[model samples]
Target chain A: MTNGSLSEIYAKAAYPLLGHGKRNVQVLKEALEQYEGELDSDMYGSGKVIESFQVKMADILGKEAAVFFPSGTMAQQIALRIWSDDQGSKKVAYHPTSHLEIHEQDGLKELHHLEPTLLADRTRPVLLQDLREMEETPACVLLELPQREIGGQLPEYAELEAMSAFCRERGIKLHLDGARLFEVLPYYGKTAQEVCALFDSVYISVYKGIGGVAGAILAGDVGFAEQSKIWKRRHGGDLISLYPYILAADYYMEKRLPLMGRYYEEAKELAAYYNGCHALKTIPRVPVSNMFHVHSDLDKEQLEAAILEATRETGVGFASSIREREGGGCYYEVSIGDRYAEVPQNALQQAFQALGRKLRHTAEL
Target chain B: MTNGSLSEIYAKAAYPLLGHGKRNVQVLKEALEQYEGELDSDMYGSGKVIESFQVKMADILGKEAAVFFPSGTMAQQIALRIWSDDQGSKKVAYHPTSHLEIHEQDGLKELHHLEPTLLADRTRPVLLQDLREMEETPACVLLELPQREIGGQLPEYAELEAMSAFCRERGIKLHLDGARLFEVLPYYGKTAQEVCALFDSVYISVYKGIGGVAGAILAGDVGFAEQSKIWKRRHGGDLISLYPYILAADYYMEKRLPLMGRYYEEAKELAAYYNGCHALKTIPRVPVSNMFHVHSDLDKEQLEAAILEATRETGVGFASSIREREGGGCYYEVSIGDRYAEVPQNALQQAFQALGRKLRHTAEL
Candidate 1:
């Protein structure tokens, strides 16, 4: 069955553990109730709703200023471009699977004419040693904390500090692709400001962990923030009224920031359960944040059937579909959020038991 | 007083002759009530809400496809860039006062590396003769309907047909900066499709005359529309959830499209009122669309005081603020909309009469 059909089935399951729920107009409706002041839409990224959220985010991230953008892709690209322009170098560096490199269709290269050096192996996070060993130093070094492609894996905090120092000493700008920044805070044992202190610029996604509609905040020194606003207008990220996004972001950030620790705990708990299943293991073996990827030795179709069987029996679904590996296995990403807590403990236990049985039987066959 | 304070006064007036009303959360709330189907938010510019709207707009504009954008600036830039790329030329042409040349911080130059040759003098539309005399042939030519910078003026339909035929004969792409496309339909006595047929691509603003929160639609042939989507993602115009914009756009277009003829009529009537006042006259001496500019020989401060005085006495407001001319005069733009209908005729007459007396006295000073 297609992923769409699988989602339909999973959506009807008694216990669904993906996101808060469907992202719909109701999402905005629920968030709007939280706002008490004038809902005056922000005009070209100005006014109270947008400006207040920018200020709050900047303060939370301990930056001099922040600007909201329509996407993390735009914010991060502009962050690197600004740094590259200042350093008079066109080269920036990130992991091989960096969103800019993979997801953005070479927007940086095409739009900004910025060249990127892939600093690390695709399977792991870029460490301080990688920066030190690189043949050519880039103007900016982007570190995606909880590097998403490798299943929310983050380099050690000390390693990040070392890299930050190295970049600063070498006059290289260090930028954070912190799309899941808040999710990793519980594991890092630090506040958002503390983690952000190590980076010259930080780009955070409001929709990812905060469960808002889509938008991002790029925070840095006042000059960087000012430059980003100009770039934002150029990129058309300055929607005349971004208050819908700002309102949803402000409401959800307030509601979800306090629960990040719980989500992280739940991710670890869920990963442990997956590891107990037959032919299944999670990347990192344990989650460093509220997200992880579950891998299976069986191919995608086999795992899909097995998961479908288990979900049908237990009324507790896993993912809608799985991605096939190059040679053999399959995998799917899991992100723990508010819905994870709603899954009944007994039902989850029963679901895992069924999943384990189905995988084992499928393997034997 | 600042424009912000003036807006406060105008907002409170009994006969506010501007937009429908305050653009707040209520605008969205009212629009959401109109949607009957699934309110699922579009994911990365896909799904039923976004797709259906794109299809509807493309049909309305008589194009093979269309793409929704966060801003008209982004849409038009990408449209021109695509045509330039296809034609294997780096040069485009537009009116000197085109939004690209004056407002966008030279994004076309900075991002796309496309050079723009300004074709027309700032005071009028770019006619066929202007294109013929341009020193070099550009890959694309942009025309902004109502030529906003010159007070919402337009060339004759035959002149537009000539321009289109000239561009097509020479294999040059013609792009319409149709921000106020609907507003001009009544004057042209043509459907949106009929007008759009003359151009290879058209970009329409959702918020300007449609009274939506904010968004834009770029409509063209299938291939052009597809290429625009890639450029959109590169520019980060593809927000994760654009349902809020889509809902408002759909709702407001339906609510306002039928009223375009009425708004156009009201605009002409309003221009006459301005022209009748001492030292006050509208550009074109009449309106060709639902929008026009009212200029005064008096200075900005003088006009502001006169406007404030008239507004206070008659409870009818004209504009929040006036823009000073290069040397002496001052002007303000007015676009007729739903709010204009609510303005009592007697009050408008009295307001203008009082405005004329105040202007006559101010000019004598």
Candidate 2:
């Protein structure tokens, strides 16, 4: 095939996440336009986009400076390394469900050469008592905002404040894994800056809710970020051109950030909708953000097939999976985003109605 | 603008790079296509493309297996880390200008927790004596082919063979930073397999010459690569949907690999063309591969302006400046690639003519 045909095929196949949506397309287009006519090459050092993204992130988080990285793992690992170096300690304290501990394949130990002191029984939220109980004082403590693996539960504001103060008093640096920071903002009754101020450093993802291509920005004081840039390049996060991601992030922030509150409100209503349904049961009585899980009596394979079929029929998308619950029935998460938020309440009701019909059919069979 | 318009803009801007250009784009496209419909999000456990890429790379390098990484830095660092762990030593020996020493921001020390024992000698290639003279016994030694920061020079085949044998005798693993190994092949009068066979692990870039979107493949024994995959996820190298890179690499191998021999010949001819000219001097006497540096007596600012103007006039690209030589002259590298090789000999001659004219004009003023 010709280059044009091949590119079309590649685009269609590769960018499955991009669909025929005005909002998604507009966000990406604006980003491309903003950065189209520039070299943006890092002739002297780091690329221009990376530099600007870092600066912007730092300012937003009320930090002195920031650095853009290709992946959150590199950023978090480097952060731990710097903390360890500063404190002259090779051990870090964090909850068991922290991305660094669970997701990063023991990179903190294997790559960074640091030992993790995992705090067990963090099913609710981390507290100062938990920090006080540690036998060995760690160089740094990692806290995740609205923990992911455990259904997005966050600690109370007073407890979080106490934890931060305790770390500060003990000369321990606090690092926040704000992967879903935006989602946590409304729930905590705080702004990004307000929440980030409690930590020495913050790492945010541009691709998650912000809907950028793929990149991360780690924000911290000038000294910290400068050091982080060196680590960034060391980890091979530095690229020749990063304007695409930077521009996409800028566009997404402008377009989608304002709608985050709406997403939260919609999520609450959706959770309430599921709670009232007979076939479906809500996991967390109240969602912390725009995400919650639903328990259902339907079979896994049958539920997945039905959801896929129903989405095709109704043009409304919902995740379908029978996840084994803590008690008895299976559960699957229902995450509401800007896309789902735009669907009218009546349309969502209709989707649930279709889901009910499908579940009943599976039950009868 | 609409999403269609946005995609069109992205396509236009990214077309040259990602199009079927017989470069990295082809490889990335191929990789993405292979895992087209799979939605496996995790890059650590049961990584999507790493296992397959490793298998393919191992076969290409004549190794037992291979590992996939997000960056060459991580791959090389992990290789050294594993070597150190196996040998129960923290020190590794490498040339002063090796990528691990200079480019990676001391990641071997900070991230991998390895001590680099530099084998320094600006005058000649590293020999067995250099390795023996090291105060500490290193766990491994790194050898970079066509050393990048040093104008792409290589050690003689006899010297390389001796070094390998010495390492073998000492029970030290040898690692090759083959970032530009493809460029080094014709110069050494050897194939990739022959060079790679001397090393325990090899790291190659898919983006550099192979022309993928962004990726590196670490080839080694099957067991070694399997372990590296776990490390890869820890480093955040595991990406979602790597089929694009795989496809692009497959296509680039088919189209660009055949042209490299011709590129080598043309680069030599180009170097000779500059050597005979009075206005410009070729460094290193002869071109080893498709890259060489040209030393000019012209002022740095004037030279940069002239090169920029020449690019606008001829639509041919060249790096403005690499660094200043010790002998009061500015140096610029000319990389002969698919694009550079396509320029006619006359156009190449004209570019030089344009440079001279701009310099003379500046002198008159």
Candidate 3:
């Protein structure tokens, strides 16, 4: 009878999973039972919950302090901004596909008024020589661990250490975009603390891999984070209270972190299985983490419909189609999380089988 | 024993009253029960709950579209960034104490890489002539209704209308920093639509007077907002879902918006009462909105301790000290909301009596 009918198509098209639903309910209950007062001032004015979360995040990341923000975009951008401001320069260097450069609509240039010196080669990791060759000195250098656009590939640990040293000698602050850090941990065979130690500041997303409702933590030295708090307030990132996210994050971390190793193993197995399949080809033969891209022969839309139908009928989940690659077929990113890891390998084979059937049916018609 | 003490003074603060615990719990339960597997895709992402709130907000603010952000800081910064990008200039004009300036550690300068042409005369409303007098044309101008730092005073509607006309004539965009716009509305006898109609874009906080957990809405023409979505994702404000704040905001708008008029009337009466008191002084003789600054003769820390003690004993929540004003006394801000309105007026008078007694005790000792 209302606007619900108009959006029903979208509602039906989306995947329905148990983890997302359970997290939503848990957050809602926390909101109702705990938070009730002036939204702006309640959190910023005197609520100690955000401060507690910051301290916890700082301790976890092995930093002196941490600040919780509404988005990693602001966290990373602000880190760059602070680095630039301290150096009294307007230049920041980062990968060409860095979230700030591609995603922020030139916010660095437009909002923070800084200039980005883009490192152009997309296929390889940024080397010290590339940074040293820049005609102008940059205020900071940003590195995204397991870059998202490139299917979560990471630079070698030795190269990262060299990059850190290079930045330090030149007095450039280093910032890490660890949005999918949990995924990268198993690939590096390193602790979160160890990886974060190399950067002056590290930003980690709570909702992405941790499976909390929504939040991010920007961890750094006490002075750096203290400065970030001022920036957070200015950017309007400080909330009324962060207890719901904090509490849920605490719970999720305990439950999900241990399962990541299993997820990584499952993803590797899935990749191997897909490589052997006649109808599909995986972009990366060996995924560095729990996610890899799959290229399929089936039409993108038809493949999606078949997958959705199968998921609805059989109660299994998998991505249907990602963006079309440079070549003829479409690429779908298969991510292994706590729940997805539990899906039987045969179920995935069945999903592809369903896609084949749908393609055959369409051809006959 | 449990990692850290939860009973610390900072930890014992109250949670914001923003959403219905039962409804939030129920929705979260349903999400977990019905839609746990479909968390990644953007099409029907469980985050649609946040989208629902945005739709409702757009309707309330009389905008073509609205985007929900994790933080008001990110929302407003992106709003200004979009305005500047559209205008092809990077300078935005606003009050010196505007959240973008005073609070953000110059992030507009550092992160967005934009410059503020400060329009710093705090004595009067920003007039059309102010824009005319600028040495160089600015990309955008921001107006903070019920300016927070200056005791919540707002410019006259006629003046704001003239400012809007000036911006249109110059092809400059006007942005309304309506962080506390709800408080200013009843005083001006205007709806949110009327106030927002004067600007190209408007930013409203859900957690401020509305009393929800942290969130903000940036409402504008659909085109401007579509661009903001890109900026939102880049800033990391886009969450897996926003149902908790959205549902709470929807409930708050219905329950709180109607009651703001009553809070405004009460604030006016309270301002009048404080003005008549010989020992206490109200900064602005007439209450422009629900918030006002109080200058008290009592010592800052002792007065704060006394006020907290009185609040605990009497269940009256009011001003806590912010900073020292020009006089020997300290300045405190009183923001009237639904909770404070429920307490009888006599509680305020009783609190004042308690304050006087505490001050006298300090002097005698």
Pick by TM-score: which candidate is best? 1
lDDT of 1 at B77: 87
Superposed on the true chain A, the predicted chain A of model 2 yields a TM-score of: 0.84
- Per-residue accuracy of model 1 over A272-301 as CA lDDT, tens digit each: 999999999999798999999999888888
lDDT order of candidates, best first? 1, 3, 2
User: Cα deviation in Å at residue A271, candidate 3?
Assistant: 1.7
Backbone clash numbers for all candidates listed: 0, 23, 43
lDDT by residue for model 2 (B288-327), tens:
7777677788665655666565555554445523466666
Model 2 CAPRI rating: acceptable
* The 10-residue segment with the lowest total lDDT in model 2 chain B: B14-23
Q: Write the per-residue lDDT of candidate 1 for residues B178-244, one digit (tens) a residue.
A: 9999999999999999999999999999998899988999999999999999999999888889888
Which structure is stronger by DockQ: 2 or 3? 3
**How well does each candidate superpose onto the true structure, as a TM-score?**
0.98, 0.79, 0.79
Model 2's DockQ score: 0.23
True contacts kept of 1: 0.58
**A1-365 per-residue lDDT for model 3 (tens digits):** 22243124224533322133344454435443443332222246234556666677787788888887766777887898888889999898888878887776665665577898887466655777778788898988888877766666677888888889888898988898888787788878988899888899999988766777666888888888888877776666666555556656656776678877777777788778667755567756777777777777666665555555656655555553345556565666766775554556566666556655655675565
Candidate 2 structure lDDT: 0.68
